[model samples]
Target: MTDQSAPDERGAPRLTTREAAELLGVKPETVYAYVSRGQLSSARAAGGRGSTFDADEVRALARRSGRRDTSPAGSDLAFRTGITLIEGDRCFFRGVDATELARRYSYEEVAEWLWTGELRPGARFTAAAGTLAAARRTVGALPAHSGSTDRLRVAVTAAAATDPLRFDLSPEAVLSSARSLIPTLVGALPTLGDPEEAGGGSLARELWSRLTAEPADAPSLAVLNAALALLIDHDLAASTLAARVAASARAHPYAVVSAGLGVLEGPLHGAASGLAHRMLREAVDRGSAVPVVADHLRTGRRVPGLGHRLYRGEDPRATALFALLEDVPQAAGALAAAREVVGTTARHAPLHANIDLALAVLSVSRGMPADAGETVFAVSRTAGWIAHALEEYGERPLRIRPSGQYTGPRPPQPLPGLRTTP
Candidate 1:
């Protein structure tokens, strides 16, 4: 039994049932109801007269119960996720600084770290020969104009079809599939020469060759690695949420990834990089960045690469990437144009250049295709989606189901419903 007259560890008083009920503005029976529902805690009273509750707990409950219930439209909803945390202008993955990870670690290492909480160096991301062949054939079947992301989606679908073990949802099996899937996806893309030539190296090297004809120099490879690491995950993004929802249904990993890709293809998500690329290219072509920024702002539309919903200052990923891009000779024009845009936009708004702008700068500098940034985004985010899927798989199946608040017109009376089909 808790001491009734004595103080708590913090010197707070314990309240009797009558006192708790009075504090909460409810009957004594309601206090018991709160305890039964696990919303409040109680202890045996001194001399076994009755139960006593912590005064602080009672006060907290009272405050919560008395608060207004105003649900704003499109307001942030709370859900538990341990994947990534966006704080101020920076992002962290599992408490590790993402910018630091991008600079020091390979994409494979980062993926493993995010997936299993271990960052093993020299981990291989190789695909089975048969799976590689199947993915290549799938990519080859697409039309000539198919974008890189489209090829990736097709390859994932094909790989899933051929892997007999794809149904395994165990953590080890899912991670094993991912290790092979990422490398195979990279190798499967159509390239100028044999894709095999691009196969035996870090994922960044492999992807670099597929995106452009340039040799995988050290600096370029570093930028690619950093980009991949930075893009690997962002907590509860629309695409990641979709992936989690699918996994909550106990869908296989491949299917979960496909669901994520379906959402990532939208203009406002993964494809935002492509839009930013075009806008930056326009500025570079015009020889002055002000006009492009002015046009976008004058239209009252969001400047594609300039702002983020989460960050109030320069995006840390953008800061990291821009610092790297500054040393590359080819990036000079695009970097200068980006600065002009940033300077001009700062005068009228608070938005700053985000990772998309940095991606556009990289693509322009490297002579990659306009959609190359989106492909990088999609491939990198596959790791995050897989991680989130693993998390969702451990939860109760279909737990994300949300109920709607009905605001539509009520059903008409029988006379009005008489014309309805039987």
Candidate 2:
């Protein structure tokens, strides 16, 4: 830690070695351990402040100790077996165009496409509707006004827990997983199982209506369906990677689904929907999104729903999704204003709305609660997870361990009465 004797231009005082070590909960020896390991950089005081270290470097020391740095994932250069591809601008479920599927297909149709890679002729949309209906019923049976994420999480965990066909990771079983998982995690209102009836057309419309209290008009529903199509898959995200890895390990469908959900719980992947919503809300509050973005840039903030690492140009999906939301009035003004701000203030390229931003627009315009948006996204993305898992199941087993560059002392024998430690 550096001294707090003088504040920097940012008006934050520097930290001291002891204070930084204390914050890291490591002894001074371990702090030196980090220094010796070339993990933490230390600098002598320039103006009476003691040796200062980068705050993130100190945190890296903590992460290295725990081995929980599961991020910065490896690229699958050697393996082409675990990925699925969508070839065109038009969204395709399996191989069926999503726009066509959206008009004529049920949610189950989309689930089948995701799991089986084929939208068969005469496919029934609600073959597994009973299971989803049961899951929704289970969620509705929970205590009133509970956090929807928690409730959905618990309900999904339990549904997977109780599933008898979970270990059958066959195409049909994977499709069944999607069908059951989506409606259960979404649909805020209760839905009873209707074995003889499949939720199609108007039934699909009703499900969309039940997802939010806001009236589902043409624009909002179209935008939401488009967002669902857009987010249904991406090329090997961490959560998608986790799902594939689990399937590669020969884990069953439920295990793969659980593993995917677990990855989604991380901030980098699944938590983005909530953050995007918050950013939109901030943009709305400030009246002009450009100034808000300028303020954020001035303060060293990263724009949440703007740029992506993979797509250097504008995200094509964002443009397509925004077009779908053209008539959505609720948050349309804010989105439009933010886009205008992006054009004026951004230096790299004007901001491009990501899937998170699109989902945020759909959720806000439909009046779904802020918390429910993520649940809906998760439910939708189960398609991609199942697809990736299916792709992995066909490949060789995955062993994802990396070599460690050791920096510790050699092993030593213990004396008598010394307790063994892990």
Please list the residue runs of candidate 1 whose C-alpha ends up more than 4 Å from where it truly belongs after superposition: 1-77, 192-197, 407-409, 412-422
Q: How does model 1 score by TM-score?
A: 0.82
Candidate 2 local lDDT, 144-234, one digit each (tens): 7765555656656656766788878677676666565565555434432332222354233545654565555666666666556556776
lDDT by residue (1-422, candidate 1, tens digit) is 32354356677888988888888877777777667545678878768777888887788667655722122222212345678988767899999999999998999999989998888997669988899999999899999999888998999999898899888899999998898888888889877534555767889888887887766667777888899999999988899989988898898989988999999999999999998899899999999988998998789877778888889888999999999887777889999988888988898988898999999998887788889999999889999999999888886676666557879878773454555677
lDDT agreement with native, every candidate: 0.84, 0.61
Model 1: lDDT of residue 81: 67
Best candidate per TM-score, number? 1
lDDT of 1: 0.84
Clashing pairs counted in every model: 0, 5
